[model samples]
Target chain A: MNPADRALEDLFQEVGPERAPSHLHARILAQLADKAEIRTVPAPLLARWQWILIGLAAMGSILLAVMLPGNGSSTGWIALLMDHLPDMTSISSTLRTTLIGGAVISGILYVLDAQLNTRVRPTHG
Target chain B: MVYTVTHRILRNDMDAEEATQDTFLKAIRGLHTFQGGSRFSTWLYSVAYRTAISRSRLRRTEDRSLDEVEGRPGEPGSEAQGTTSDRRRALEHALSRLTPEDAAVVTFHYLHEMSVDEIVTATGLSASNVKVKLHRSRKKMLEILQEHLKEEVWTLRTE
Candidate 1:
């Protein structure tokens, strides 16, 4: 071997990582579990509080749908039906009541989702 | 196996056990994004390195001095190499003086037996940089050990 290579070999023998204490691996693994790729959400996603926001949005939509005159049975998309159906006075009262009930159920779903999320979150940032 | 990543981070056998658990927890969660390009161990090492560095930083800040200084075997000047333990200690002492980054490169190469290319992937350093660092770091370590050995010989002759 060249002098440089030989020197390197000798040096490696002196200050190599193998001499490091063994517990370092375990410490690293523990830290990783809490913070990195293994977690349910990425750090950025958790930071944004996206799950909470999504839950809130779902609840709001359900509320609007339930309180509307049509019983959420409108032919168009639920949001659009809720918006335009108010103009249709000819709709039956029974249909409107059913739609209102459905909206209430949706709102309940959102609340449940929010509660689940709150349970799963880390306590101390 | 004796020189594995796990042992390096936490010296206490118990502490090492806990750290290994933590490392796997972190690795499993991040497994999906791990491209198949690198060895699992290499990727794992990066995670381990980050974890170790963060802990070291925290410990330093809290204690106002590094606490992991006890395991070093002996000063490089000690030429007591008749025993395996002596040589090992000499190596550890010589390594302790290196900057953490240089120490890391040396470890990856020697302890893990990683190639320059593997180290490049693991450390995210350019291949040329790895070569340069490895070269310089090795040279410095050898010089330190040799100087110690020479001093020891001189002392023996004088005595």
Candidate 2:
């Protein structure tokens, strides 16, 4: 190296980088602490297996309802659903309206709850 | 190591400290992604270098000019005259005048004792690019040193 480069190497060794401020260490540790706390709080059960379990239960219910021997017909699942379609319309108007309204409100609330939970959750990188 | 890389780029103690903190946080969060293909220190240096660059860019956008945001070099300490500390302060002042990338390249080459290949890994530059930048940075630092410490350079050259 030339004289100037040698001098700079020496100077840099002497001075080095400044030590980080004490408070910055504290701030980083605090963030890590918050991250650890967030990790420790187990994810909600609904967030983990609720959807899968719901799908499985629905599938099981449909299989049982369609395969029951009392149907007295070798019809496919779609045909069975079509056969029950009239029974669904036979329900009273007030009961049907109330059920449909309740289902819509429940779906909306579930979606909103999921969105709020995601928004509040702490993100890493 | 993080502080050294960040300080070279940011040229401000407070900003360097903030960048260092950010680097650590990012490294921790991204730890699972680390493939262990490089040395841990090299990977950490990469994080610090990128964080410092990002912080510099953010500051530039907010302040409208880098020169306005960089900290003014401190006056040489009187009691430390003619000592190693004096020479260090003079060198630091010169470094402060360099662009952040130039200063970072110089620091990584000299102070960190990083090979050009290692620097290429840290900075994500090609091998030839890293070599070219290192050469340019060295020339710039030499110019700065000669400008700021003419007598000292003369003395060192003679010795």
Candidate 3:
């Protein structure tokens, strides 16, 4: 830029763009605070107790399933299917217990995932 | 910075203020979409410029009959009133008379000292377009100041 242009530009520096009103700054901060409040809140502890109770109920049900009589006394599809199939009586007891434990743990995880998704999940900036 | 950009483009406080608020909110909401390529401030100004321009366009389209009741937003010399210096007043008056985009471009270049590339990144305008706007706006403002001040001065004409 030439001297004239530089001088003209300098004049702009003497008086810059309009100053925003103080209320506008307060208003912006208020809105951001409102947003943080809405999004950053943690879920209540009562809901945490509910989740613990649910996990206990699932564990108790699994224990009941393991202790209950097998397909022998019942007449459902499993009983009929087991009647035709070769028995898992030949498998090791420890392996059968491990398989049952894995299935139960997977079911617990699925339920927990769904519950966590619907309820409070932490967020990052 | 965001407010100033919107203020120059919109030429009125209420709309410019609205646009400035909208720009920040939009930036917050859409921040995840921003890649790390540009500076955060540049990305922000990009959002601000687009929001202000779009709002300005919306205002124009909605008011096809025009809002003549207000009768021209703020006049050139009207805002320059309280300034302590005559030259500053003259420049403000001259800047106000340019097209809103040109005024904003000049303000970005002169007041903010933003480079042509930064302007292009912020405004989505081509580099040449920004250059042309700056060059023409500077020349035009100089003309306005010299002519206006010269005309206002008490002079004696020779025979």
Say which candidate scores most in DockQ.
2
Residue B101 shift from truth in candidate 3, angstroms? 1.6
**Which candidate model has the greater lDDT, 1 or 2?**
2
Candidate 2 lDDT, tens digit per residue, B25-68?
Answer: 88887787788988888889999999999889878665446446
Off by over 4 Å in 2: A1-4, A36-125, B61-71, B75-80, B150-159
**Each model's lDDT:** 0.57, 0.69, 0.69
TM-score of each: 0.51, 0.63, 0.69
* Per-candidate DockQ vs. reference: 0.15, 0.27, 0.27
lDDT against true structure, model 1:
0.57
Residue by residue across B1-159, what tens digits does model 1's lDDT show?
Answer: 323454443333444455555556666666676897888888887776665545544554433333454434345444465354555555666666665556667778876778999888776789999988887877677666555544332122200
Docking class of 1: incorrect
What shift in Å separates residue A49 of candidate 2 from its native position after superposition?
15
lDDT of 1 at A47: 30
What's the TM for model 1? 0.51
Model 2 Cα displacement at B115 (Å)? 0.7
Residue B36's C-alpha lDDT in candidate 2?
93
**TM-score of structure candidate 2:** 0.63
Q: Candidate 1 residues A1-125, lDDT tens each?
A: 45545444554554444433455555554566556532242233233356567557556655554555545444457666457544545654655566556656656765665565555444211
